[model samples]
Target: MFSDSEIPFDVIQAYLETHYHVHGRAPTTLQVGEANALLAALHETAGVACSAFLTACNPFSQQLEPPRNLELQEALAESLQQRGLRFIGGIGQHPANGWPGEESFLVLGLALDDAKALGTQLGQNAIVWSGADATPKLLLLR
Candidate 1:
């Protein structure tokens, strides 16, 4: 079961099932609703109580050309950089589904309100947010 949202049920399922892989030192994968020890450690190491995994590609889940998606992702990265936010590259991959892996970012220390605002501003349907508990939750925007 999933929360009520404009997003399709199947799409929500895909989101929950997707592996959100974070890169750089201490690479680890995050799963929805599951407490990740690595993520908890990362939060401690990064000195952040919260983080968000988000992408600017496939606005509202509408598939876009690879080049366009790449452009959007790069823009998102630039936006974060401009804000001076610490972030790590990530990818949301759902192997069970045929959808391609989406490039995302694990933005450290982004508050819930700010994360939601950024996701909305980027036209994303949802984002994965984790608190101090380090359990990722799918937050629908539409």
Candidate 2:
């Protein structure tokens, strides 16, 4: 299973903030802590066996929906399509979102640490940059 430390703090927070307890809606940023908790719980529930991509979250569950979440699924789809991520329906959301505007964290597919380095390795436009940086956080289940 992936721990919060495993991913970039910002993207982790973005995942937690938006995906936690969502009901067809993006979670408010204020609930970031709650989101973190949900991620931890999902990891544990998944047996923490260290599988590929950490399963993000069970497709059946609301917590770990995917990087291209409902809030940004449309945008994510466009990105995947453009990037050749392809539409593999029934596989659940892609592991990440790489859109310039929606890049909540590191790029998709790459580990959090790797994503973090992308910006520095390449350039500002090459990576996900939040116009406004907010609090950095990690969450476990409630």
Candidate 3:
């Protein structure tokens, strides 16, 4: 779990604004925190050496079909690997909100420049952030 002191409210707010600009709605604080925590955990688990984290959220609404979700997951993994990024652990149902229609968070670790390049390539399919900056950089591949 990442502390609020590490992420801060302002950073989360900025992320929310970026998310809204891409998704057209605001995500709950829990959703934002879940992504941040997952990213931080990846960094910590890697001994604080990861330069950036790339995360993709597969929302239930977009994955009504069972195979669609799995396909998305596989595609995300393959995409990261194709770019030479490392796939880290992912969290299902961020925040454990106990909702039937929660989202899945897929995490990837890569260099900051690589992550940024991938983000540009993805173009709204996922969210990209640098651990060093603590600010969301891009939303890709939607």
Candidate 1 TM-score, true structure as reference: 0.96
lDDT (tens digit, per residue) of candidate 1 on 34-62: 99999999899989999999999899999
User: Model 3: what TM-score?
Assistant: 0.43
* Window of ten residues with lowest summed lDDT in model 2: 49-58
Those runs of model 3 whose alpha carbons end farther than 4 Å from true positions after fitting are 1-63, 92-109, 112-128, 133-142
Each candidate's number of clashing pairs is: 0, 6, 11
lDDT of 1: 0.93
* lDDT of candidate 3 over 70-97, digit per residue (tens): 6765676787667665454333232222
TM-score of each: 0.96, 0.23, 0.43
Candidate 2 global TM-score: 0.23
* Residue range 1-142, candidate 2, lDDT tens digits: 3253434455444444342121122232223222234223333443331111112222212343345354454554455457643122222122345312222322223334543343333222122211122222322221
TM-score ranking from best candidate downward: 1, 3, 2
Question: Pick by TM-score: which candidate is best?
Answer: 1
lDDT rank, highest first?
1, 3, 2
